[model samples]
Target: MSNNKRVRLSISQKIDLLDQNATGQLNQTDLGEWAMKKFNLDQPLAQQTISNILKNAETLYSNVNVVKNSKSLKTTRYPQLDDEVEKFVADMNNSNLPVNRDSILRYVRHIAQVKCRIPGKEISFSSGWLTKLFKRIGVRSRPMHGESASVDISSENIQNELRKIEELLEPYDPVDIMNFDETGLYYQQPPRRTICSESLGGLKKSKTRLTVGLLCNSDGSYKGHPVVIGQHKSPKCFKTRANLLSMTAIGKKHEVVYHYSTNAWMTNEIFTAYVKKLDVAFGRQNRRIALLLDNASVHKIKIPLNNIKLIFLPANTTSKLQALDAGIIANFKAHFRAQQYDRALCLYISKKLDNLDVYKMDQAQAMFFLANAWLKVNPETIKNCWQHTKILAFKEKTICDFEPVEYPTSALPLEEEIVAELNGMIPDLPGNFNNEVTDVSQLNLEADESDMIVCYTANTTNNEETAEG
Candidate 1:
């Protein structure tokens, strides 16, 4: 008779077999017989092992406990490396430089080799290590394309300045308080992506842009017409007799006024003309008015006007303290882009139906679209923007109860659906086309040419002379 040798089962193998048998389809005797035949164990030994496994089955199934002490060499832990990386990150953030994955990896490798004195062969800063490092440091990497350099809005100096402005504004009526700012529009550029053919490599868009100045009262009761500045004194596109006549007629009908300059920028001369218009509109009113502006060179005009006061916001505080920057400009741009998208879709559909090869927009059309967008901005949006800059404090009582203004349907676009459809139809769309305009509204309450405002307390002669002069 051949001798049968018993097989020794490993702990993992034993656990696996026990787990399989734990289903309770077979009784203990049957399981023991099966183990004896399959694992080449003696009947008595199999029965004993099976009993022990069943008894300890609860502990085995409940916990994995996979980690085991090893006698082999282990990697060294560098606790100091974390502190060094944190310091490096702090220095990078403070330097106002872009911090991206590649830059971070390069920084870590440098530190590991030079600062930590780790030999090149021994140093390893894999992507996994970088990920873990970022997690431990509690920092996330993201695209911050247009974010302003960090400002200490809560600093003592900023608080004191805000307090001073608050005291200065206490006496003015909400209607008499206003924020003035300017923005630029790239009117011809459709959002980077639109319904287009995937086969096309790229689409080159027109670079034509226009600058606009916007003013609105703190209570949203009044919004000044947009003052549009364009590059051509008489654009060739508008030189046609019919086009010129149409432009003239449109200017007369709309609140938006068009101006021309070499660069389409708001110069002091153009700004002076705008202030004159503001003077005619609001300066004649008996009530004192306070206009908040940023410290832009163009806003420094010397021309004096009657019954108006200019308050220059603290330096670099425009992002935090300027009401227009808080949301008004952003809303305007969003509305403008939505209008453009609608126009493009309409034109595309019309061309397709007519079998036309192409469709394009002219300056006149862009200006009209801009005017319509300006009008579409909700009055409530303007009022809420003031709240961001604390211009309209929650505790302050207004002349009338705040009524919510209804936003037009045109201002609300189904952004996700529109974008997805556009991308599907036109895969060649530029990725960055929908980015908000980055033009800073460079405005200052102080005019370089004149004080722009005649003090309410000044002598009548001085006020009259300043206004007349």
Candidate 2:
């Protein structure tokens, strides 16, 4: 277990040793020279016994010892990370904290090159040793629930929407289905804490888990033809019908512009105005358009618009049927993470408050950082999106032989499902599952039921083996 006993050579030493016998077929004397070069030893260290040394090394340390641990058997007077990489690593350690190895590896990999000019900081070699070290330390960083948003969807509505979506699925044309919706765009960083473990430097805010809310599509970065929509991604005067209808992603087709609108945008005026234009744009006659929408108050609040069909989301369950929640949004975030190498598209957001204790500076700087990140997100290359949405089924009351519960009468109706219906539930190609997700069983249930036992069949998955072993 004590790696200190092993001989490990620096990359430079290995390269120098390999240089002598370019063919790597050396006689005993040459082997002695190679060993001397690799270990920086005095000549004649293994002068006549080069073969014995090589054989002994192979027997004791394995064949890879010649290359893998060329810098073996050297312990520094100060046993710390490289000086250049210290800032990147900061106080990460294995104290009372998780003793997390993978977290450490992630921290190391993320900040490796950013550490310094030295390449050793780039990545870890000696997979066996790193594995051993990680096993010894263990991962302290574990992901919990998304703390900010607390939205829920019911199983009953999930089933209904599944039925509706299935019926709608009868007529197939991916290009025909158009999804629309409005989400908030807050310029903020995810909460970070100092990693508080003995082995870790405690949770510190590095550019980690940066989450942003962007209204995009299953296929493209929600392109609102900034060329046409200008600065008003949403209208300044509380979003109007014309504002929603007029908004276009410079190059996108008007008919294909079906997206969702939110009551959060507020007002029957904007909702009505937008619906009218959308009606004229995709009249039932022009091309047979079915509007999918969530049961936001406005769709029902406004005196019903004739000719425009409104698909009401099940009471208290749009999150279940909604396409974006289970589909496009997941895909976008995945793309955002996969490319987080060499500081790709991620920003270092600092929460330095102004004298008034406002996060204005953080928001301003964060938006600026996100603007550049937008360029990196092409939103074209992704897969398996909406896999979560396809098999989605929500039922209010199970018949029998399954989990039972009291449905809340006060629960907000599963109203949001229609946003996709109002816009036409859009399907994405393999590419742009950027936000595509498998149905993440948010199953947010508080213990109102003492009688219910939430158990499942013995699925017999040994996934927890990694943790236990």
Candidate 3:
């Protein structure tokens, strides 16, 4: 049998061929010869492929229907398989797993062999069948990446915890209710893709990063200045440059505060200083202010401060319960990336004319980008994120009610677009960049002490009155 001569036949043609061979009007050899001539095959069909089709002729005929007085062919094989495949896809989606042709084929074989009691050798899950199944099911496979797993959002315990937070917020206004979370940004890391020569298989990207703490109120009424933490206490980049202080001033204008740690980790002491600043800025001396935070070790405060309450979300539930995770952080990242792209474009143009290396991003540039990105995040986005987690419900009592809106889909340009803008400046641009900016905030869940308490005291003097959770 010549593999190259094989021709794909329509369902009606297959059914007619089966009937002709079954009735003995044409023997198998004669039918094969006739099929070769009729289909003008370049090579003969594989015997196994042909035999499988012949053996399943009746099953195919029964499963498919031919339109009356027409040559239209339609298949209705294994209707239940569609439902089973859909459920399998749904399961994969919920677990944040990737689904592809190979995975689907494996699943189908499993169903046939184990669930349907069919022998593994008897199951015929061809690539063609898989393709048709995808079309029938209206699903297209796309590249996907895995995310950190946490507690199930719909679990009873998580729901109850969220409800408790909602009730706890009833006494305070939106401005008094704030959510604080921290995430790491690889400021100087090249995008997952970079323009490089083909000789370089993959560009070595930078690991230079900074941890940023974001604070925003539930009502979207106020967004506190971002607290940026870097590795060095006073980086030479800022200390040596005469104009670097001016760049820091740009961040300050956008309400971006700077801090530093030995390892760039948000420590309890740093968090305390941040909270004290928050108290002073928000004027929490007399009013009760609620600060919602995820269960992170760095967020733990040994002693409580005045008039500020620290509420920790349920363990392993930040992905679902944290307002920052809902969408605010994502928007902030998008804006930051957009700024990076703009900088790259400017460099590309400059490098073309002046022959200067424009790929390296400095700390000052990174801070400027970060500050502007935070400012770009609109109040609507903050409010929507809080509402999304059901932590704060928007009231419709007033004529102008806060309507939850998503971050605009077109707010950030596609990576492809950015690359195109820099076309010809760099050779062999990567098809895709590693761009997996790890949301370190979600991945690092280890607590320094399990019994650590975060207390909100009435004032700096009244440290004795701490609310223990």
Candidate 4:
């Protein structure tokens, strides 16, 4: 009977309380008067509030009735398969005697594809195909994580940087250590793509979704514009490879800089040409590069491959502990989302929502819109977004999920290679979130800045709590 209590109420409990009190004998006037006395409500406010509440009670009741009706309306009747379809089912049943998930999906997808091809699209299997398949066949597929990328990270190079930074940090200020990395931005990349197993889903493509990679700094600054790659009709090997290699350069003119050549920054000529470009981007200085690298095998080709002094981040840590992730990538993803939405809207206005058509709308115009929006964003804004974005936590008793990662075993001068888990101390979160954080950053990367330090974490499995489809 008492509404006044220190405890919080669950949604259902609050609704039940409203029903119990509102449906009781008191009229609105009495209800307001009673509330004022019983619940310590202000006199005038109570009267107006209770008046509005009473008027809306019928609408709330209507909502409850609608929910109840929908829940109770249940029917299960298998629509008889056509004679031809029936024969197929009979053959499968007679041959196998048991239905499997893969077979079910194969059959269903084949049927759905055929039906979809028919014009007017009148042929629908069921609105419940997703739910039905999930229930009957079940989705065991999941998004890829850290180890899916082979680690060519040169531990020797990293150890060398660690030795140098450990000496530097032991005496100097940590803020001076600059940590930087490159991350992909999904512009046309279906920020919301349907995922399936890499092997079985011959139906799925890797670079199918458009993606752009960015070179990022530890303090949350980017050197140049993110490579604005678009989606391919179907994913191409070299195109995906090229797009990933993309990252804006930094140096005095042209000098070997970061650890690995990206989809963007690779040297077409000898390594010195790239170094000369880096020199132009970053003036020659005593700055050591703190690198957070994927353990891809090809990374071992450094020194012989090029000439940038470097430090390597610990294995399996970029997304977990990298300040860029904490500061930039997480925020960038959110900012990029809104950016994409606005960009999409703008392109739609011109009756050209296609990626390529919109791309031609003037690099100046595109930069103008993004710069206007970007000016409003900053590191704090992005860091705050990182606080809310869902991350898949690792769930290991020991470290079984951690595989033996290879360092630089050995490598030729010019081979190319390209780019985890937890849980239960706390409930796992959805591995990703499109938080409404709109903050853009003002930080800029100074090539003359000191050697940067970066850290990140990766696990074998990500929990489903924060998992998004």
Give per-candidate clash totals.
12, 87, 11, 73
Model 3, global lDDT: 0.71
| Best-matching candidate per TM-score | 3
Model 1 residue runs over 4 Å out of place are: 1-97, 107-150, 153-164, 190-206, 239-254, 283-287, 349-360, 391-469
Question: Runs in model 4 with CA error above 4 Å?
Answer: 1-172, 184-218, 221-291, 295-309, 325-327, 352-377, 381-469
Please provide, for model 4 over 181-251, each residue's C-alpha lDDT reduced to its tens digit, 9 standing for 90 to 100.
44443233333443566633222222422223334333344333333333322234324444322221122
lDDT of each: 0.69, 0.40, 0.71, 0.39
lDDT of 1 by residue, 218-328 (tens): 878888888889898766566554454364325554447779899899998998888877787775666678889988988888988786777888788887778888889
Q: Which ten residues in a row have the lowest lDDT in candidate 1?
A: 66-75
- On TM-score, the stronger of 2 and 3 is 3
State in Å the error of residue 461, model 4: 80
Listed in order, each prediction's TM-score against the native is: 0.54, 0.35, 0.59, 0.35
Q: For residues 1-469, could you state the per-residue lDDT of candidate 3 as single tens digits?
A: 6336446776666676677777877656677776667666665544565676798877777756443223334544566677788789989888877778898888888887677676666546888878767776667877542133545767888788877876776677777888899999988665675566675555466778888899888777777777888888767767656375565533346646778888787998999888877667556446678999988888888775677888899888777677898889999999998888777778787675332334457776777788889889999998888888765653333225657678765434447655455543333322112322222222222443332222112232243344331
In the order shown, what is each candidate's alpha-carbon RMSD? 28.0, 25.1, 27.9, 25.3
List candidate 2 stretches off by more than 4 Å.
1-140, 145-157, 188-269, 283-292, 299-309, 312-321, 326-384, 391-469
